[model samples]
Target: MELKKKLFPFFSTVGILIVVLGLYAFKSDSATTERYVAQTRWENLKVLPQNISKDSLDYLMKNYALSLGVKCTHCHVPSKTDPTKLDFASDEKIEKEIARGMVKMTNDLNALYFQPHFPEPKPKQVHVVNCVMCHRGAVNPEKYLSQMGEMYKTYDPNRDNRKEMFLEQQKKQ
Candidate 1:
C-alpha cells in the first residue's frame, strides 16, 4: 500500500506534466497552421483580383455600410466617376453628417446599456466599422448572392455574353 501511494503521486504529476506539454505543443502547431493559411490566402487574392465580380463588391459594400450605419453614397458619390473629386465624390458635407450621426448613435447606445451597468467612469469607445471586417478573405459567392440580390438583378448575361464565354473558356481548360 505504501509503495502504491508513492507511485500514484508520481504518476499523477507525470500525467499532468504530459498534458501541459501536449497543450503547449498543440498551441504552437495551431499558430504555424494559421500562418500557412494566411500565406495561401494572400497568394490567391493576388492571382484572383480580376475574378471578383461586381455583385461581390456590392455585397461587401452593403455589409460594410450597414456596419458603419451609413449608406453607400457616403463612400461612393452617386453617378460620379472619380472618387477624388471634391465637389460630389469627396464632399465634406456628407462626411460630416455621417460622422456626426455615427457619434450620436454610439453615444446613445453606450449611455443606455453600457454606462449604467458598469462602474467604469468613461463610456465604452465607439466602434467605427469598415469593409475588411466581414470580407476579410476572398469573396464568398453564396453570401454575395444572398445578401445583395438587388445589385445582381440587372446583371444581363446577354450584355457581356459571359455564359457563352465561360463555356468556351471551360472547354479550352
Candidate 2:
C-alpha cells in the first residue's frame, strides 16, 4: 500500500508526460502534412501569378470566356488521352496566346491610366476598362461598327479624313 502510494505520483507524472509528448508529436506531424496538402502547384503560369488561388484564377478565366463569347475549349486544348477533358496547361491553341496578349494589354492600360498616382488617393470608384468594354460578349469587336452606322462600316481613313467626317456627323446630330 505504501509502495503504491509512493509510485502513484511518479507513474501519474510519467503518464502525463507521455500523453503531452504524443499530442506534440501529433500536432507537429499534422502541421507538416497540412503544409504539403494546402499547396496547389499548377503546371504552366505565364501572365498570372503562379501562386494565385484556384477560385480567383477560375473567376478570371470565366470572365475571359464570357467577354469573348467563347467556351473553355477556345483557350484550352482538349487532352490527347482524354478527349472530353481540357488540358489547360497546353499552349497548342493560338487563341491562348492572343488572350495572354490581351490580358497584358489590359494590365498595362490599367497601370498607366486607371491606377491612382497621388499619395493621398481620392476615394472614388474609378472604373477600370477590361475585355468586356471592347469585346462586349462578341468574339470580334469589329462587328460593333455595323451597329454604329453605315458611314462607319464603309469609311476608309486612307481616302476620307476621319476627324472631319466625325465632326460633321456630330454637328448634324
Give candidate 1 regions above 4 Å deviation: 1-64, 67-72, 75-89, 92-96, 119-123, 126-173
Task: Kindly list the per-residue Cα lDDT of model 1 for residues 58-82, writing each as its tens digit.
Answer: 6754665565456656544544555
Q: Assess each prediction's global lDDT (C-alpha) against the native.
A: 0.51, 0.78
Candidate 1 has which clashing residue pairs, if any?
Answer: none
Q: Would you estimate the TM-scores of all the predictions?
A: 0.23, 0.59
Give one clash count per candidate, in the order shown: 0, 0
**lDDT per residue (tens digit) for residues 1-173 in model 2:** 99999999999999999999989876656656766656478888888888988888999999999998999998788899999999999976667777887888888777777767634665342338799999999976767645555566766535424435655777799
lDDT of 2: 0.78
Clashing pairs in 2: none
